[model samples]
Target: MLHQPAAPVGKDPAQQYKMRLGVWMVIAYSLFYGGFVAINLLKPLLMEKTVLAGLNLATVYGFALIIVALLQALVYDAMCRAQEHKLSDQKIAGEVR
Candidate 1:
């Protein structure tokens, strides 16, 4: 017995859009993350200052990094889905016409 995929898979129409979006998001995230590293290196004592709710800069920035990554992931997912939907609709429209 052989197993088969539920849906036929082929080339992705949104490949280019996905790649471009992914790369830009990565660069944006890297820059944001780099700021944290820069502060730690250049101004190590600055991390001890309380920023919010008595949380030190290190604690706050650490948590912010996690939250930002999750938010970025959500944004990336939504954008990719929108692009895929747009391309899929165009393909369907072309097929109908």
Candidate 2:
């Protein structure tokens, strides 16, 4: 009789991490793109009043997008750190077993 190899027990942490990161990336990109498009679409109405001289709608929108990107980076970093901590704890527990 041929002996069969045992099936893998649990999910691979690295793969799980990659999968999660991919999902978050997709979500972030979608939100960013959607917001950019929406801003462009509403630019005429939004910048009707001239709060500052020499400031065009495109310039203001560009600055806002930069700010949004920075915030997204911070959020993503925090999420990655949390995921790392959780994975480390899981690894320690597995090792103890």
Candidate 3:
């Protein structure tokens, strides 16, 4: 006999959406990091090129990555807050019915 996969184990729709959003953010960050690694490994000299008065390409790229990470965190926080609000509203609505 074949076994069926268990249901989401009390996971509600909002919870699932939040999980998916988190995974997507992780994937985005990973890909951004991978690009930097690839560039460094493929052409170390490329990173040494001056982007600013003294800053090199590598330094600029690294800083950009940090900014992106912070932005992602902010977005994630907002999304989670919205999801929590929505889920709470749903619960309250259900209770009233």
User: Of the candidates shown, which would achieve the greatest TM-score relative to the real structure?
Assistant: 1
> Which lDDT tens digits does candidate 1 get at residues 26-64?
999999899999999999999999999999999999999
For TM-score, candidate 2 versus 3, the one ahead is 3
Q: Native-vs-model 1 lDDT?
A: 0.95
* Off by more than 4 A, model 3: 1-13, 52-54
Per-prediction TM-score: 0.90, 0.54, 0.78
Shift of residue 47 alpha carbon in model 3, Å: 0.5
Q: Write the per-residue lDDT of candidate 2 for residues 1-97, one digit (tens) a residue.
A: 2454486456556556756776887688678667768866876566444445677655666676788767777777777778867888999999999
Which candidate order results from sorting by lDDT in descending order?
1, 3, 2
User: What lDDT does candidate 2 reach at residue 62?
Assistant: 67
Q: What's the number of clashes in each of the models?
A: 0, 0, 0
Candidate 3 yields a Cα-based lDDT of 0.91
